[model samples]
Target: MASYKLYYFDGRGAAELARLVFKQAGVDFEDIRYTGEEWPQHKSEMPLGAMPVLEMDGRKICQSLAIARYLAKEFGLFGSNNMEAFLIDELFEIFAEIMNSHLVKIYYEKDEDKKAEIAETFKKDSAAKYLNLIEKRLKENTSGSGFYVGSEVTVGDLLLYNSMYGHRKWLGKFGVDVYEGRPLLEEHFKLVGALPNIKKWAEERPETAF
Candidate 1:
């Protein structure tokens, strides 16, 4: 089997979607993690001065989105047509934007009061925009089928699940339970989480305290 080495921080911040995609595809790979202290020294060796680098067949790749799309294409999670791939990319960008904004406030904001305000606004805006969009997408997918993006699971579903899971964990500090009014999204989360492959992977994977 082809294998990969994924280098990232100890937490599941940026690299998690890739991790989950690999697990769902049941591809065996090496997961390399670093601490904050170790990352500075480790940074120069990476392709783009960034963590979350994925190496396959001795070739290194950078940028979480590029790495994710490559893995998804390899694992058959990408949509079948150019149009579908374009749609997949669109969804990926939406989730990425939302996640980045929340992470920035959490990591960069200096004032406690301002951080709280930012987080609350993040939860509201993200929930209102991204979650609602996902809810609509899932409802459309619900024609007696349990897949998002197509007749079967695709990269979009996995990425959305990881984002929702991360948001649920991250927003808890602000007391923003993400599932309060979004029943469709809650069901979507549960549906994706209960995938037999995903559930088993979650059980075997090393738990990272996000």
Candidate 2:
């Protein structure tokens, strides 16, 4: 077995997907969480001066999605065929765009008025449009397994669940509910939550304000 060590902040943020992947794969790896006060000292040590670096067998891998993709392939969650992998990659990209372009901006917007305005726009436009598209894709691709890709769970499903989980956790204060009117998504969320390994991970993982 290869030695693995993941370094990230105490909060979930970008590292949650990788953490989930590890847990779901039944892998034993070191999860090193840093405090805000302790980050500066370790920041320069990271390959890209960022958190969520995964050190595998002494080689460090930076970037959250890159690590997640590597773990997904390692854990057999990348999908069964070329077309399935392509679709899974597409969904992951779409989720990342939504997070970086809309959700993260709204979450960190400090000015009250500006935050409210951006939140409103996100709720009305970005959230609504993209969430509906995801719901439709899930409904079309789901073969009663509640997974976004094939009959088995894939990185696409993990990405969608983590993205929505972040939205609900951070944007709820602004009264943003992305699952509204999306029953398929809501059901999918429940299904993912109920997965044996995921349920244990959720129950055991530290609670954070992410």
Top model number, lDDT = 2
Q: Write the per-residue lDDT of candidate 1 for residues 104-192, one digit (tens) a residue.
A: 76668778777678777776666577767766766665445556666777888888778778877876766767667777666767888
- After superposition, candidate 1 runs with Cα above 4 Å error: 101-103
Location of the lowest summed lDDT over 10 successive residues in candidate 1: 140-149
Against the hidden reference, what TM-scores do the models get? 0.90, 0.95
Model 2 weakest 10-residue run by lDDT: 170-179
lDDT of 1 at 26: 80
- What TM-score should be assigned to candidate 1? 0.90
- Report how far residue 206 has shifted in candidate 1, in Å: 2.6
Give residue 4's error in model 1 in angstroms.
0.9
Query: Per-residue lDDT for 1-210 in model 2, tens only?
Result: 789999999888999999989988899999999999999999998999998999988898899998999999998999999988988888888887887897678668789778767877887877777777777788787577879888998888888788778878776777767667778888888888888999999899999978
Best-fitting candidate, measured by TM-score?
2
RMSD of 2: 1.3
